[model samples]
Target: MAMAAARVVVEAEHLLPPGGLAPDAVQTPGPFVDRIVGLGPLGEEYAVVRR
Candidate 1:
């Protein structure tokens, strides 16, 4: 559920036109990161190995 929502937000950001806002106008509140750890049958194994 959360992943779906986050993906939507990321996709929407990609739709925004270039230079719509000043580069320094926005800042993340804190450290933030997103990543796709794995997919399909070997996903669990890949995630564990990545950790």
Candidate 2:
């Protein structure tokens, strides 16, 4: 009962917008990729791994 109510509340709140957590994350792969790419961290990985 408690879990179901919590889920309903979460779903209701998740109807907000793009920056909202659950709604935004529903489709995409989350912001880990964006944060790493934005910070240029992948360059180090590529340089270290490439021959």
Candidate 3:
């Protein structure tokens, strides 16, 4: 995955919609992003859903 190879900050609103990223807001799509940095006050990291 390109994101896995480098550092990337994805723009997201929430992570509890129970569905994939917003169709219109999808920048990289799936299969390319191996993970996603969660929203935190002091900058935290978390793994998102995988294919």
Candidate number of the best lDDT: 3
Rank ordering of all candidates by TM-score, starting from the highest: 3, 1, 2
Alpha-carbon RMSD, each predicted model:
12.6, 12.7, 9.5
What is the TM-score of candidate 3? 0.41
The digit string of per-residue lDDT tens for model 3 on 1-51 reads 455666545545466554655678666765666566655443334345332
Candidate 2 Cα errors over 4 Å, as ranges: 1-14, 22-51
TM-score of each: 0.22, 0.15, 0.41
Better of 1 and 3 by lDDT: 3
lDDT of 2 by residue, 1-51 (tens): 433342221212223445656564554343322221212234654776542
lDDT, candidate 1, 1-51, per-residue tens: 443445422212233355675768535311232532333354655666541
1 or 2, greater by lDDT: 1
